[model samples]
Structures are given as C-alpha cells and as structure tokens.
Target: MESHLLEVLVCPLCKSKLDHNREQQQLVCKADQLAFPIRDGIPLMLQSEAISLSSSET
Candidate 1:
C-alpha cells in the first residue's frame, strides 16, 4: 500500500485511523474492531465489506 494513501484512509464506520497489516493486505481499525480489505492495491472501505475483529484480536 502507498504511504500517502494509507495516511488518508480511515475506518468508514468510526472514521478513525487505521493500522496497515501488510501481510493480510488490510487496514485494521482498533477502535471499531474492523478490518477493511485491500484488493489489487485498492482499499475496500465499505462497512459491509469489513470483517469484524474478535475480542482476542484486540
């Protein structure tokens, strides 16, 4: 992911900062406990497309 793009991207639900998980190619929102997937270098920021993080993940 591009650093510039990552800096501007935020969680679509909570509008919070996201941490990049390079291995999974996802943007993780710790506050919202959601993971937004990145496909073909584009982030799918839609809430419906996000995966909820488990309690153990937090």
Candidate 2:
C-alpha cells in the first residue's frame, strides 16, 4: 500500500486508525478487532468485507 493512502485510511466500523500488516496485506483496526483486506494493492474498507480478528490475535 502507498504510504500516503495508508496514512489517511481508517476503519469503516469505528473510524479508528489502521495498522498495515505488510505480510498479510491487510489493514488492521485494533480498536474494532477487524482486518480490512488489501487486494491487488487496493484496500477493501467496507465493514462487510472486514475479517474479524481472533481473540488470540487481538
């Protein structure tokens, strides 16, 4: 993901800052316990598309 875009993107559910997980290619919202997937370099920011983070992972 581009640094500029990463800087501005937030969680759709909670409006919280996201942490980019480069290995998984996802933007994680720790506050909301969600992970937004990045597909083909584009972020899927929709709440419906977000993956719920496991308790152990959170």
Candidate No. with top TM-score: 2
Regions of model 1 farther than 4 Å from truth:
none
Q: lDDT tens digits, residues 1-58, model 2?
A: 9899988988888888999999999999999889999999999998889999986775
Off by over 4 Å in 2: none
Tens digit per residue, CA lDDT, model 1, 1-58: 9899888988888889999999988899999889998999989988889999997875
Task: State each model's CA lDDT, in order.
Answer: 0.89, 0.90
Best by lDDT: 2
Clashes of each: 0, 0
State in Å the error of residue 39, model 2.
0.3
CA RMSD of all predictions: 1.1, 1.0
